[model samples]
Target: MPIEILMPALSPTMEEGTLAKWLVKEGDTVQSGDLLAEIETDKATMEFEAVDEGVIGKITVAEGTEGVKVNDVIAILLADGETADDIGGADAKPAPASSNAAPAEPSEATEPAAGYGRSGSAAQEDKPAAPAAGSKNGERIFASPLARRIAADKGLDLANITGSGPRGRIVKADVENVTAQPATAKAEAAAPAAKADAPKGSAMATGPSTDVILKTYEGRPFEEVKLDGMRKTVAARLTEAKQTVPHFYLRRDIQLDALMKFRSQLNTQLEARGVKLSVNDFIIKACALALQQVPEANAVWANDRTLRFEKSDVAVAVAIEGGLFTPVLKDAEMKSLSALSSEMKDLASRARDRKLAPHEYQGGSFAISNLGMFGIDNFDAIINPPHSAILAVGAGVKKPIVGKDGELSVGMVMSVTLSVDHRVIDGALGANLLAAIKDNLENPMTMLA
Candidate 1:
């Protein structure tokens, strides 16, 4: 049988991606683990691998084709003894562009679709089957070989496990973490409750239509700049964040004279080791420790509950072309200043290049967005959801400050605004979190302890 190779979902949030390039062409013999294509998702560009060994009978989706949806047939492969003729009427069509239509629903085909690793064996048909209630319309469950093996050993049902891998494919991590009970049961029970609790009506205005906007500027000459996946995702996510998240802002100004002096000393000593730390590094470390100090504030809203973390996972916003990436620095409180600086630099560089993996830019309870280097005085940041708060750091400038002696003196002062999700953090907790950050920055040497 000619197996259909569907476009893989590279990330959890990826609905569609650009088929940047094809590594193999029709008639090329490919084996498992061979690189098949470079897919550009909203977050990054990743290489897709061939999961089944076969001859590339046809390529349905061409290189440079954008907006290929998940589970849409991208190519066709011929198994042993099968030729291109076997693909006769089975010519899979390219998925419709996401903007124009939704992905086609699964059909009632008895044979499962050939996914990542499965060959769709019928020998197991006689074996006792797990509940197919949660299965995606009897569609094939994509899973890594290791995940399948682990699931078998643990007596876990693959259909019940929600894959976190590309296109929701089950991977080793998914299987290892899954409980003995069927996760689908819980999900089914929660779905209606979640839907009912969701706020009614539209949370945000759609604004004027594109046609209306164009008519309004009929006389003006303009070049239409199409939004790429990254820009579009950013716009959608931030818009939703602003609309849904109940945000409260907490402002603070911290004197950096002591920190400046300490940083200078440290830089001079570490110059031989090629380790130079920036103010942002200190800010990251300070916020991390502050999360630990004000532990009550280090939590995220999970619809029905609050998830608090023992360690601070800090996400720092890195501005890339067209959009930004908030690559997370996990367990920031445990890392040294130099370590954080090095990791931040690496993450930022990769983020700019669109080379970071999805996990690198996801899952942090708090975030820091510093426009200090750009000389921005102060700004309020939007809270990225699931995150309790985000701290917006502004540039440090020389300002007259009244000391404890009531005498005015010039000191470097940096303004910051902590945007809190009122659902997860109260006013007092947000204040405490901001105060801890300020104290940590003011007493920089204590962070080393």
Candidate 2:
């Protein structure tokens, strides 16, 4: 039997996905571990792998087709020589499977996404730049057959005529309403009588050459290519996350002077053992240990329950070319510092290049969005959903602190803010969690222990 390849839900918040690219196309033979396609989930344009060995029969979903719901069939894997039409029924509909889903009613939490039922349009502002002159036709504009007939009957060239369809394909109404005069006017079109009344330089003034002039000494023109799939996904998701997550800021400055000294001594001693410790790695270990101490804050906001995850899947937010992605360091509480650092290095490198598989980028019990390297003083982060809170780390700065002897001493202090989902955790609970993390960071020995 042919297997239906459903769009795998990458994140819990991912209700639908856009088919970014197909690593394997129709008639291609794929092994069980082969890459099948790249899916643009809410968070990342992650590589989806094949789970079953078979010949790729039909591609139910085309790349760039967005708003395809979860579990919706995007492709088919069949036995040798089977065609796609033979597997998935010929009656199958396209992206945004036909459903009785009504327009979503606005509520306090949902009003932000009004008119977008599950079947609503995928964010199109995130689409790649419009094709360069003479590029291949992207999603053909949607037009009714009647409209096509009307355009044909009217001798209206669809090419010159602009489309008013969903993706900008010419429709019947568009053909009827265009300002182009009839071909009969071609005789009188450029006649002197017509030219006398025409506004001087009107067409030239509104012409398209003026946007950005790029001409070479040799007379070659230049056109800049656009943001790739990874970049577009990064922009849309991060923007939506920051805007909709209802963020409230919290900042705590910590004395990291002792912590830094300890790390310096620690990295030197372990240098020969191939375990070099950075202060941030130590901070991650500290955060992991602290999470174990206060598991309540590690819960996700569910319908009626604050869902507490049992594992310590620590999502370390890493930055890449166009945006940021957080590939989780799973079971951080169980891994040694070296193990954690090694795993993080491998994942971070791949994530930055958009080379990570869906599994590597998915699932986290908690999150850490660190901007310490960029020298950001402090910032609040959105809770990458299904994970209740995210810890934002700022740069460590030298500041005066009261010594045990009541004398002023210079110390290194790093600021951190934990952005918690109000529905999942309370403010006091988040504060306690931050205090525990601070303690672990202050006592470097405990993080190692």
The TM-score leader among the candidates is 1
Winner by lDDT: 1
For residues 265-320, could you state the per-residue lDDT of candidate 2 as single tens digits? 87888899888877768777877887789988767765557678776788888887
Lowest summed lDDT across 10 adjacent residues in model 1 is found at 124-133
Clashes of 2: 1
Predicted candidate 1 versus true structure: per-residue lDDT over 113-178, tens digit per residue = 325322222322221222111234325567554566567666576766787776676767787877
Per-candidate Cα lDDT values, in order, are 0.81, 0.66
Quote each prediction's TM-score: 0.79, 0.58
Q: Give per-residue lDDT, candidate 1, residue 383.
A: 91
How many clashing residue pairs, candidate 1? 0
The local lDDT score (0 to 100) that residue 334 gets in candidate 2 is 90
